[model samples]
Target: MMELRWLEAFVAVAEELHFGRAAERLHMAQSPLSQVIRKLEKNVGSPLFKRSTRTVELTAPGQALLPYAYRILRSLNNAMDAARSAEGVPTGRFTLGFSGMHNHDTLPRITRALRENFPGVDLNLVGGIRTFDGMRQVRNEDLDASFLGIIGDVGTPLRAREISRHHLGVVVPTDHPLAHRDAIPIHQLRGESFVMGPVDGNSSMTVAALQICHAAGFQPEIAQAVSDPFLIVSMVAAGVGITILPSEVLPILPEAATWIELEGDPVPFSHGVVWSDDNESEPLQAFLTILDSIFPEPTLQ
Candidate 1:
């Protein structure tokens, strides 16, 4: 089979019909350009050019093959472009896994960064996974990667880099007596009903809250099992119950509810970026590079 370079020379010469011009267009010496066309003609078992000192012309076979040459070269160029689309380039889509809080807290920034730098790459946001499920989805290739709030030490096959560590806090109605305090002991809430994620809530925040309550020496009275975090805050604001969440939740707390610091030794809640070890796509790699730059290890303030 003839190589692409040879066909390229043949096409250039055919189009220009002038050795000097073709050579210049190809950025090659006239002698080599002539040789490449001759080699192509020999491979095709026909003369491709009718040449003289003053000019050159494509023979009948050359004319017949010209369209084929153009098509083949065009196809090859398109194939090369397809091979280069990082995540999807020119126009590509990247699937990113995001859990509840990170959708607002983290994903928007990352998606914006990627859009600005790589406008061709669309960041597909997949949400609603609980902490551990995010890790599993990333490992299983159901998601390209995820930002998860890990509650405790959990082993995972996916690669992870913690973005932030949050100290636990209590969100209570503004009129509540404890809400006036700057900080409160977890144990002090023993008599209070808890508004929390469902017992089956997939969130690490939920697990951490339950664990903190249990560690405080009591099983909280379940005021409600609400999955929507903001709604949980609404319930608290309505005085239905108080709840424990990360300090980061302070920003989104309703006016009726406020976050109080946990007064004691801390076992922090951490949000991490997790991805499959087996994922090696160029686009995914590019996203990972950008992610590391923006959220380098232990950059928690």
Candidate 2:
């Protein structure tokens, strides 16, 4: 039987296609790496590489074995992880990032479920990170996962699973004329002054607000831009300007502002969990399993 280390060496050399670079990558001397490759080739009864003075190329047998080597290594890693989890070994700390746009009650529930299933895990919850920043963090392995309100593309090496959809609404001061109405048509707010968060390219809330306004056939007039969500809410309550927000976020604010349903077919926004597809850590896998159990399907809220 071929040893796992032999496959490891084979894969490293096969991909790098250079004994010196592969040795450097494997943290060993070039001579030993070459010996391992020679042993592997002898075991297979076929030459694996066409070695030259300046270049090393994979032979036909090496080409056939490269993919199998990758699969074996990956499977061995998964098996080790599974064994560690089954033995209840501490999976270590996990960090979750969010932008505070998700449902208020959802975070606690997710954390609680993970704790119940894996008591050995240390949980760290990070909030107030913008969606785009969170995406970058996840891709770079700074965050294990994040609750994202993605309005557009999710980018590569990262995947998203949507949990809920929210309809658009408008928030106005209680004393504002539009606040007295049960609902208002989208086009009625055409000339109205709006207060919102800064126009960061990745802010789902900002993009959703702008899209709805443009869909209504008018560009909104901006009065102020604030970074803090609560500050934006305070400005609206102080009669600085009305702003558009998802209906789910309206309930958490002070009662000084009133939420009016938007008339007409306004575009809905999505809220979901985002994580790096490349992450195969035990804790992240457990967290994802719990999240899926809690939110089996996307609900329109």
Off by over 4 Å in 1: 1-82, 86-91, 152-156, 299-301
**Superposed Cα deviation of residue 16, candidate 2 (Å):** 32
Span of 10 residues, lowest total lDDT, candidate 2: 70-79
Best by TM-score: 2
**lDDT of candidate 1 over 1-301, digit per residue (tens):** 7999998998888878898989999999999987888888889999988888887888899989987886687556445545866345543456787766545677777777778877765578886777777877676565778888865545655677788777778889999999889888888999898898888757888888888888889999988997777788899999999998777777777899988887887657788777866555555666776787787665333
In model 1, the clashing pairs are: 85-89, 87-283, 88-92
- Global lDDT of each candidate: 0.78, 0.83
Worst 10 residues of 1 by lDDT: 85-94
Q: Candidate 2 lDDT, tens digit per residue, 146-238?
A: 987877778788999887788879999999989899889889998898998888766778888998778779999999988767778889999
Question: Local error of candidate 1 at 100, Å?
Answer: 3.9
Off by more than 4 A, model 2: 1-90
As a whole number from 0 to 100, the lDDT of residue 212 in candidate 2 is 79
Please report the TM-score between candidate 1 and the true structure.
0.68
Q: What is the lDDT of residue 287 in candidate 1?
A: 79
